[model samples]
Target: MTKNITTTDFSAVKAADKAQSYLFDNFCELLTRVFMALEEEEWATQAAWDIAFGPSVSDADAAWRLVAFQAETVTAVQPLSVDDLLLHRMAGLMSRAVSATGIDALETVRSRAMHCIAQAPMATAAAVRDMAKEALSTIDQMLEHALVCDGDDMSVRALPLAA
Candidate 1:
């Protein structure tokens, strides 16, 4: 279960300060979890490792408390693969969208993800296509939360941004 701040002070200013502190801590924990999950991915890089372990959690393995990641031990280097690149890029764009990507950029990503999903059953591997579809679906959920679009020309307006 999640634990919240405990306080006895009832002053308005003190309560606001406590609330801000709680929110900041919650935000950091969420952000840290995101990076740690990235560090567990098949395409995880040095950057991901640094981001995940560079904070208070200095030593991260495949397991953290009850959370465990399936070990991916493929060290063999293979030839270049565009599908891998495209899939990772799309995942990165979807998962690490911390700020408003603006309506236009989000639309472009949606279009690209859709095209990748629509390619013939012969094009990219089914796994890549499936992951792309999942990422696009997640982005659509995010758009539903933050953007309102006109059905006519797909024009969008931000909803005062999410906090």
Candidate 2:
């Protein structure tokens, strides 16, 4: 099992000053918890939101606000990491979960993630480390598939194939 993720630095570094892969890893970690909550059925009911985020401050409305604050943190990074599809998907799911009136949207996102996990290479023995490794490798593969305007822009191109 992974250590407490709340201890990890969740800061949003500037795009040019940070590595994309690093940001991707952090996003993966956060979503992993959200998906686990869903997969375990803790997020299947209305009361689960407060429990997933934290205890309520006096009332349920306070709990919802706290959850919204956490969701905002994830959504704020979308524009900064615009190139990553998975990141956007996770962020959107999180945003919906926080604002959603019913559990249907959350369940749909959970189902989608479960489907991906079922098809993943490590589906049989899918440890967190294995999933993290796969996430990193996927980023590398995305690099290989990136579109480049020209070979002159070295920043975006993958390794050239041998002649």
Candidate 3:
């Protein structure tokens, strides 16, 4: 005869899943907020600076550690200047904390965005908008994936009750 599992066992699993879900949700929300803040029209340059040196961590050393962890994927793009490398480092840290693949794609788009910004004075307005669109699309996808994962986890925990 098959032995039935106790409600207590299921409850424990549910609790663990809920905690993981909460952590992922919070991380995703923070990423979205930062992305939105950086995307504002007036704060473009400042946003880049903030992304590189924001007060997200306790100190520069901590920030550097986070960046170093994800450096490999980010450094695969074009050779970056010191300043550009710093920004890429920040992007790497942010991506590792959220979704690595999505964030890596975002960083590539961001690099292109910076290129467009640098050339804005000589380029057509349409070109600038296109670059911005690419960055925003990546951010949108990241947020969507985070939300879906959160929902799926919560649903898994609720399945027994629903049944």
| Candidate topping lDDT | 1
lDDT of each: 0.42, 0.41, 0.39
Q: Model 3 over residues 76-161: C-alpha lDDT tens digits?
A: 44322333333333344344433333434545545654564454443333532443344345445444543443465322221110
10 residues in a row with least lDDT, candidate 3: 154-163
lDDT of 1 by residue, 4-25 (tens): 9897756966765565444333
Pitting candidate 2 against candidate 3, the one with the higher TM-score is 2
Any idea how many clashes model 1 has?
Answer: 0
Colliding residue pairs in candidate 3: none
Q: Could you give the candidate ranking by lDDT, starting with the highest? A: 1, 2, 3
Quantify how close model 3 is to the true structure by its C-alpha RMSD in Å.
Answer: 20.8
Model 3 stretches with alpha carbons more than 4 Å out: 1-7, 40-163
Displacement of residue 158 (Cα, Å) in model 1 is 6.6
Candidate 1 global CA lDDT score: 0.42
- Against the true structure, candidate 2 reaches a TM-score of 0.36
lDDT of 2 by residue, 76-125 (tens): 55434233434545445545544543334444545554454444443233
